[model samples]
Target: MSATRICALSELEQDTALRVEVEGVPMAVVLDGNGEVHAIGDTCTHGEVSLAEGFVDGDTLECWAHGSAFSLTTGHPLNLPAYEPVPVYVVTIEGDDVLVDPAVTRPTN
Candidate 1:
């Protein structure tokens, strides 16, 4: 499937997330410490906060508003204050560009 270019890989640092919108869908593209890219919903389910503004540790992104932790790989909440799982998007790297497919989601494990 075709993926939309979110940002350049050079624009993202390891262990950080960059917020982008695809077809009006707010998405968070994360670069883990191990140099892997992950994509998840940008909004925190527990509050009106941005997950991209939160902290990233390994594969988890901790919501700054309610301290809820969400897995970047699965988009599942690993803690309270957020019982709902966020949506995950497909991430692709085309050369130096970071592409994301908001319509395609991987099954949560």
Candidate 2:
């Protein structure tokens, strides 16, 4: 499947995460302080909680339930409690639109 328009780019605040669901898939969209957009699974692997409701530090999203931080770029958990990494979706930007493809994922390195 192709990328679907999630929201307008202007609607996102820097250093924060926005929860969006596309095709029944839950995702956390983040616009970092560096003006970069990222899409990852909204569910935290450690606590089964919403990562979008957590904290955004630089390129990492911290889980509010257990304090586990996941990389917004690779979706890898950088600390304990969350050994499993979330899925990182491909994000596309067109003018003022922010798009995400639930079927497409970035390879974690």
Best by TM-score: 2
Instruction: Estimate, for each residue in 16-62, the C-alpha lDDT of model 1 and write its tens digit.
Output: 88888888889888889888899999999999699999999889999
Q: Candidate 2 lDDT, tens digit per residue, 56-96?
A: 99999999999999999999999999999999999999999
Q: How accurate is candidate 1 locally (lDDT)?
A: 0.89
Candidate 1: RMSD to truth: 1.2
Candidate 1, clashing residue pairs?
A: none
Give me the overall lDDT of model 2. 0.96
What TM-score fits each model?
0.94, 0.98
Model 2 bad stretches (over 4 Å)? none
Q: What local lDDT does model 1 show for residue 36?
A: 87
